[model samples]
Target chain A: EPEVTQTPSHQVTQMGQEVILRCVPISNHLYFYWYRQILGQKVEFLVSFYNNEISEKSEIFDDQFSVERPDGSNFTLKIRSTKLEDSAMYFCASSERDYGYEQYFGPGTRLTVT
Target chain B: AQTVTQSQPEMSVQEAETVTLSCTYDTSESNYYLFWYKQPPSRQMILVIRQEAYKQQNATENRFSVNFQKAAKSFSLKISDSQLGDTAMYFCAFVASNTGNQFYFGTGTSLTVIP
Candidate 1:
């Protein structure tokens, strides 16, 4: 089955640097999302992207965070300036439809901001 | 806002036995969907099963099944004849129909299948 794939399975960066996590969702999928989980915490929704624009986001998705489908296939999440608290496992997910469909999740990229 | 709650933080089931993981949610939206995802040691999210709020019939896949009670806002996953491979962290997720399709996930339940 087709699956969502992410690049740089692990990322280590400085606190003041910018980091862009890349994801390639299923080719025919319509909706894409970003979520993060602290080592022992619940997964928290970051943002959703569809039709080339952001569909929704949580309070944690502040101005420092931005998502863009730079190409028809590559979806990217850019953090302007990383923080230590930003260190977590970031996951990318996609679904063929908006509702009632199970979203396919990628293996996830573990980000460590020091 | 939608909130998914998984009251059980950890559980254990003997091999070949049946186990049920509880999940409940608070959602004002009538139209929504529920899902159970399994994450093993690899931490990869795998879709175990899904249930649509409008569907009265439960969803089952192989040894995995869901008991969805819409009126009570409860969705629980039942794993029959569990195996060692079934040991993993399970998360219950929810998404409202017209609410932009952002998934709300519960804390998660860690299950260990004992041999």
Candidate 2:
């Protein structure tokens, strides 16, 4: 079965440095999302994208965060400046439709900021 | 806003036995989706099962099944014939049907299948 895939399974960056996490969602999927889970914490929603635009976002998705669908298959989350709290497992998910359908998740990229 | 709660921080089951993980949520929207996801040691989030709020019948996927109580706002996962591979952190999630596809996940229940 086709699945969402993310690049740079693990990322280590210095504090205040910019970093981009990349994802290649399922080819036919129309909606994409980004979520993060700090170690030992619940996964928190970051943002959702459809038609190459943001549909909704959470408070944690502040100015430092931005998402882009630079290409047909690539969906990326860029952090303008990484904070220690930004270190977490970031997941990318996609769904074929917008409503009630199960969204498939990627393996996740572990971001570690020192 | 929706919140998913998994009260049990940790649970264990002997190999070949059965285990049930509890989950409850707070949501005003009548139509939504509930899900169970497994995050193994590799940290890959895998969808285990899903239940549509409109469905009266609980959803089942092989050994994995759900006891969804829409009225009570409770959704629990039951794993039958538990195996070592079943050991992982299980998260209960909720998504509103009519709005953006953002998932609200619980703190997670770490399940250990002991041999």
DockQ score of each predicted structure, in the order shown: 0.76, 0.78
State which docking tier applies to candidate 1: medium
Model 1 Cα lDDT, one tens digit per residue, B40-82: 9875789999888888999999999999999899999999999
Across B24-63, the per-residue lDDT of candidate 2 in tens digits comes to 9998898899999998988678899989889999999999
What is the DockQ of the complex in model 2?
0.78
Segments in model 1 whose C-alpha atoms lie over 4 Å from true places: none
What value does the TM-score of chain B take for model 1?
Answer: 0.97
C-alpha TM-scores of all predictions: 0.95, 0.95
- Model 2 Cα lDDT, one tens digit per residue, A73-103: 8999999999999999999999999867788
Query: Model 2, retained fraction of real contacts?
Result: 0.87
Model 1 accuracy (lDDT, Cα): 0.92
lDDT of each: 0.92, 0.93
Per-residue lDDT, model 2, residue A13, is 99
First chain TM-score for all predictions: 0.98, 0.99
